[model samples]
Target: MKRLLFIIALFVVPAFALEIQNLRVVPKNIDAGNVTRIMFKLSGPAKLSINVKGLNGASVTSLISNVLYPAGQFSIPWKTPKKIESGYYIPVITAVDQISGESVTKQIETRTAKMISLPFTTSDLPGGNKEISYSIDKAALVSIRVGINNGPMYKIISNWELTQPGAYSVKWDGWDGDHVIKVDQLANYLIDIKYIPVEIDALYVTNPKNISKKTIVPASEILRQINAFVPKYSVAVSNKKIASNSKNNESINLDINVDDNTLEELGDIPYEYVLYIDGKRYGEIENTTSPYNWEISTKNLSKGSHVFTLMICTSIEQINTRSFKVTL
Candidate 1:
C-alpha cells in the first residue's frame, strides 16, 4: 500500500510554482490634484487578480477584478480618484497558481494630495491715516478693484495681470483719477486678487473708523494671512517656541512662532527681530521682518536682571512688530 501511494503522489506532482516578485505604486508621493498609478510584478505561470480599496475598505473607483495573464512577467495599472482628500490609501493584489493551487496577496499604500488657500487682511496705512495700501507678492498674479459695500460704482486700480509666477506687488496710491480721495470719505471698497496656486475671494473692506476701538490689528495677523496665500505645493508652516539667545551668563529665553503665510502674500521679506529690555526695545531687533520666526541668542548680554523685546513684521506694505520681555 505504501509503494502504491508513493507512486500516485509522484505522478500527481505539480508542474510549476508561482511567486510575487514585487508590488509598488509608481509615484510614492501623491498630491491633492494628481493621480497615482499602481504596478505589480509576478513570477511563474499563474492567474492574477488585483483589488484596490480605500482606508474605509470601500473599493476605489475603476479597480474591478484581477487581470488574467499567461505567466512569466506582467504588470497592471490603477488610477487614484481626484475626489479623495489628503490621506493614505491601500490596495490589495492577489494571485492564484493554477498548477499548485497556491495563492498570494500584497497590499500597497498611496497618499492623497494637499490643498492650500490664500490669506486676507484689512488695516490702516499708518498714523490714523485714511490712506490704505493693498500689497501682495509681485510673483502672485494680483488685481485690485474697489467698490462700495452696497454701491455699484467700482474702480480697478490694478487689472488682473501676471507679471511673474510666484510674487506680485501693487499700490493703491489712495487716489481716484485726478482727485485725491480721502481715506475716510471713500466707500467701503472690496479688494480681490489671486495669489499663484491659490484664490482669495469675498475679502470685506471697511473704513478705518468702522473698526472697534479695542480691536487692534497685530502684525502677526498679516503674516498669517500672507501664508494662507502661498501655494500648498511648496512648503509647510507651523508655530513653535524657540530659544531667542542662550550664551555666557546672560541669556534670554522667549517664544518665537514662524510660518509661511507672510511670504505668500508679501513676497520675499527680510528677516527682522526686535530686542526689548524690561518690556522696552534694548537695541531694537532689526531686519526681523520676514514670515519666518526669530530665535536669537543674548549670551553676550550683560549679566543681572534684564528684560528682552522681540518684534516681527508681517508685510512689506506695512511694518508690524510684536514685543515680548523676559528676565535673566
Candidate 2:
C-alpha cells in the first residue's frame, strides 16, 4: 500500500507583477540639434529611472531619476547634445515594483544619424581621367548624376546604389552616358552626388548576454525616411565681374560665388569648382575661399554667343550648378 502513495507540487504566478511593454524611441535617427522621444508602457505601479548609455556601458545622458508612476504609458524627450559622438546609444529603464519589490531593467538602442565627417578626395588619371572617391561611416544608398550646370541630367553613374561602409572610388571618363560627347562640351561637367542612410531597426536588449549581438544592427532593414534627411544647396556667380559681351580678342574676368547662407552653414567644409565654356573644359579648382575668379580670353575662340557653366560641390558632395550666357 505504501508504494501507491503519490506526491503533488503547485506553482503560483503573481497577479500584480510589474512589466515594461512597448519600449521604443520615436524618430530613431536624429542630428545633434534635434529632439527624440523615448516612450514605453508600464503594466503596474513602479518606481522608474531612465538614462542613455553607450555600448561600452558608459552613461551618455540621464533623463529621469527614481520617479513614481501609476501603471500606464509615459514619454520622455531627449535633446541630442552637440558634443555627443555620432554612433549607437541605448536608453536604459530601471523599474522597481511597489508591491512586490521586484526589479527589472530594459534597454532600447538608438543611433545618431547626423552626417559626421566627409573627407572627400579626387585623383587624376592619365588621358584626362579622374578617380572620384569618398568615405562614409554607415551603409547607404548613393546616387551620382552627371549633367550641365542648371541643365538636365545626362548620365547616372549610380542610381540609389547600395554601398557598404568604407572608402569607394568611381572612374570618370568625362563623357556622357553613351560616350557620344564629353560632359565638358555640353556644359560644366556637374557631378551631383547624394547619400541617404538605410534605416536601422531599434534593438531591444533586455539581457546582458545578447547585448553584443544586438548592438551591431543588421544592414538588411527596409529603407525609411528617404526624403527626411536630404540636404539642399543653391549656387550663384557674382555679377560684379560677369560681362554680357566681350570682343573676340578680349579677356573677361568671371567671378564665381556660392550662396552666402549655404557657405556659412557649411563652415570649414572644402568646396570644389569646375568651369566650362561652350564645348570645352576651362578650369577646375578646390578651395575654401568663396567668389573665385577665372579669366577667360576670347582670342582663340569663335566669335559668337557662348555658354558658361559653373559647377560647385562641397566636401560632402552637395552640388549646385549655374549657367551664364555671353556674346563675343
Candidate 3:
C-alpha cells in the first residue's frame, strides 16, 4: 500500500508543474489610434483564472470568466487608455491553474501613442482677386473662420468647407453685406482662416492685370507683307495698343510717316499700327493719310519701362516687332 501511494504522489507532482506555452500578443506594437489583443496557451488540463496588471499598478480583471480546458489556451482583449501619457507600459498576465494549484505569468511592454503636427496656412488667389485657398498636410477635420480686424465673427464664405487636406481652393466674390467691392478698394481687403497644425509652404494674394493701352488699326495692301512674318503674329498686330488705361497716365499718341517709295506697294490701304504692353492689347492706328497721328491718355501705367509691341498688317498678311525699353 505504501509503495502504491508513492507512485500516485509522483504522478500528481508532475501534473502540478504545468507551465505557460505559446504566449503571443496579437499586435506587438499598438499605434496611437488603435487597439491591442493578447493570447496564450498553457500545458495541463485545468480550470484557469487570468489577471492583468499595468506597469503603474493599475489592474484590469480578465474579461473572460474561469474557463475549463484540457490545456489552458486563452485569449483576452483590453482597451488602451485614450489619453495615454507618453511612456512604456508593461502588462503582466497571470494564469492560475485550478486542478494543480500552479500559476504562470507573462509580461509584455506596450508603447504609448505619439503627438502629431501639421503645417497649414491661408492666402488670396492671384490678381489680388477675392478668391482664397487653404493648404495643409493630411486629410482631417478642419475648422475655418474669417472676420475683419476686431470685427464680428462670420463663417468663411461657405462655412468650413472640407478641403482635400493638402492644397485646396476657396473663392470670395467681392462683396460685404450690400456693398459691392470697388476695383480700387480690393487691395485693402483682409482674409483669415485657421486650421489644425500643418506645414504651410506659401500664401499669395493676386491683383488685377494692369493693362496699359488699347487701340484699332486698318488692314492695308503693303501691310500684307508684314503679316506674312508669322501665322499668329497677325493677330498680335490686328489688335494694337489695347491697355487698361488705368496703369498708364500718359497720353496715347500716334505718328505715321511713310516713304513715297513704299506708298505705291502699300496701295490705297494704309499700314495698321497696333500696340500692347504686358500682354494687354492697346488700340490701333491706320496710316491712311501721310503723317497720321492719334493721342489718348493712360490711367494705370507707373513711371517705368513697359513692354511694347508694334504690328503692321493688311487684310491678307501682317508683320510685328516687339520693344521692351518703352518708358511710361
Across 229-282, the per-residue lDDT of candidate 3 in tens digits comes to 111222112124433344244665544444454455455554676555543567
**Candidate 1 per-residue lDDT over residues 1-328, each given as its tens digit:** 9999999998995665576765666565554345556565667656666675543456655363555665554445445444454333455767777667788876643211122233545455555423333344422333344433442112345433322223323445443322323323554755544333222111111223332211112223212334332211112222134343465424434545445664554455444444444433455345443344444456655545443324343233212333223444
Ranked by TM-score, the better of candidates 1 and 2 is 2
Of candidate 3, the 10-residue stretch with the lowest lDDT total is 213-222
lDDT winner, 1 or 3: 3
Give the TM-scores of the predictions, in the order they appear: 0.28, 0.40, 0.26
User: Candidate 2: deviation at residue 175, Å?
Assistant: 18
- Computed on alpha carbons, the lDDT of every model, listed in order, comes to 0.43, 0.64, 0.44
- Candidate 1 minimal-lDDT segment of 10 residues: 197-206
Kindly list the per-residue Cα lDDT of model 2 for residues 181-234, writing each as its tens digit: 577555365677766554434422222222221132222122322223233455
Model 1 bad stretches (over 4 Å): 1-16, 62-64, 109-328
How many clashing residue pairs appear in each of the predictions shown? 40, 1, 53
Comparing 2 with 3 on TM-score, the higher-scoring candidate is: 2
Task: Output the lDDT of residue 229, model 3.
Answer: 16
For lDDT, the strongest prediction is 2
